[model samples]
Target chain A: MSFEKVEHALHKRRKSRNIGLGAVLIGFVALVFVLTIAKVVDEGDAQRAEQALRINPPKASE
Target chain B: MSDASLNTTTQDGDAGFGDFFALLKPRVMSLVVFTALVGLLAAPVPVNPIVAFASILFIAVGGGASGALNMWWDADIDRIMKRTQSRPIPAGRLSEGDALGLGATLSVFAVVMLFLASNIVAAGLLAFTIFFYVVIYTMWLKRWTPQNIVIGGAAGAFPPMIGWAVATGGISIESVLMFTIVFMWTPPHFWALALFMKSDYRDAGVPMLTVTHGRTSTRKHILVYTLLLAPIAIGTAFTSIGGPVYLAAAVVLNALFIKGAITIWRRDETQAEADGYRTEKRFFALSLVYLFAHFLAILAEAGLGQFGLGGWA
Candidate 1:
């Protein structure tokens, strides 16, 4: 007896949909990671700038 | 039925990824993306590149969510209308329940992500835009009133405003003008479409201007709205966002748009039917170009200003 399974078009379509969804999810995760990194870096820069101003405050009348 | 036959039947009704994507109304989403991007770019405040990109994506997803909700709500009419007959719900590739779930989920996701990426104001505007499009426009205004498109157009006009908020964290005259430009442009644009897309809205039983009022009234309405749109489109030139490039483009485009409206207004049914709505169709095509070119000119002006030549001092 042959032991082969027939692949239906429905299976292919479902598979494609699953892959598309998987790709979207992965892409979303990567985006969030990048966004978080960018936000953290931005806040850090702002904090550093604030500190620098405190340490070497500008003269009132230049 | 044999298994093979059953499989064939099942596959025929099965939806692919693209079918699901169609639920988002990608074409409309393109307009949302472009206008929103322009708003973000043209703002006086400089957004971090990453924040800008993320905010735009969330705005687009929010726009798409509303579209899906619209498709869900209007599935019946969509099935009747020739233009929208091939949408996923009408085509039986996706169910209304599927659309509802996707739309609801994405709406929340987009709003929350936008808040995290940008500020509360931008996120709030995005949320309000979604609510306006899905509930106010789709559920209440669309089928109930002839003024549907006029009011519903507000939902579309919000994206650029949201984009500006992303950069500036507040609304300004520039953003308001951007909003008004789109708000005024929508009626004439859609009315011209209704002129050419004869009997589609009528057959669908949607209270489009053509259905509620006769074709003659719709034509007259288009002329009036186009006339109103002209000053706003041209006047935006003097705003902080506008410059010489925008002014020149606006002058030419508005002249052409008004000329098209007059031609449309003058024509009777016999003349339009004889030429298969050539003038109306041409007018419709020009309307699309008119809006895009105006926005492009604004973008061009902003770009030039970056290099010390954009807006008038």
Candidate 2:
């Protein structure tokens, strides 16, 4: 292969490597961020539920 | 014009995702994200997880946009400086036009999205931060003043305040204190680097403290700023985020930081060079830990308060 052909091939390979790495990074960040928000929502809902039962009681049947 | 010419013409386009990301200055972006996260968590109000996540994400984007624009404008000086010469623009990995376009696009996206997710106050702060870093610090102060890092440090210092505003919907004394911690810390941190890398600034004609005021003056300035930073950092403990744990950490860290600054102040170029700038480099590295630990301490305090185990009794 000629020098030009080799150089072009290397550049293409490098671009592919970069794209792979970028995908992994963005994916990891998004996953962690979503998990954090889920944890917050779950905890907040539990806390509110506990408070609701404490603040109000059901009437007993005659 | 053969096939070789076509390949050569497309060389700049050969830049990949990494090149564009490098334009964002990921390392700096990470620091911005971490500090902003701490600020959000430490606030007095409760923030929804999704809201907090979106706010931090947009803030990080705004921070990254600032970095891109900084690289765009500083491409000239960056080409001259050894420490920054390999950045995408200077290394010919990407074109300056591409960097500017990326910065501008991200800046608008971040600000507009932050407003939708958070509030006008948080979004306004983010917008100002982008404008300050890009227009004020990078374009104007960087090339014009020897005190560039001193005043320009405000750009980095705004993150925590923006983070605070995201939750609180306004500014407060606590947020201002956080801002001051970073602001006061900036000079000593950067002056240490400038001490060792004076030649870079001199060659680039950037007028850093070491370049304009000379090393003697820079050393003195570092000590002065360190002294100022200690009280503000320690004083943070007495506020809503303050507690024994943070106070203890602050005392110890500031003592060490102050001692390091004094060491930098007392030594001459001969002593510094004799040891291969080991002292200056140590101070520079320590400055990073110093800032990181202070913010961490604040988080610890907030964490403790969550369970009735921390802060002023």
What is the two-chain DockQ of model 2? 0.16
Model 1 error, position A10 (Å): 0.6
Q: Assess each prediction's global lDDT (C-alpha) against the native.
A: 0.91, 0.88
Q: Judged by lDDT, which candidate is best?
A: 1
- Measured with C-alpha atoms, the lDDT of residue B197 in candidate 2 is 84
TM-score of each: 0.97, 0.86
Per-residue C-alpha lDDT of model 1 across residues B1-313, encoded as one tens digit per residue: 3465465543433678888788888999999999999999999999889899999999999999999999999999999999999898888888898899899999999999999999999999999999999999999998899999999999999999999999999999999999998999999889888888988999988899888888899899999999999999999999999999999999999999999999999999899999999999999899899988988998999899999999996
lDDT over C-alpha atoms for residue B290 of model 2: 92
For candidate 1, the share of real interface contacts preserved is: 0.61
TM-score of chain B of each: 0.97, 0.97
Q: Which residue ranges in model 2 land beyond 4 Å of their true spot? A: A1-7, A10-62, B1-10
lDDT of 1: 0.91
- The reply for model 1, stretches above 4 Å from the true place, is B1-5, B10-13
For residue B305, model 2's alpha carbon misses the true position, in angstroms, by 1.8
Count of steric clashes across candidates, in order:
1, 2
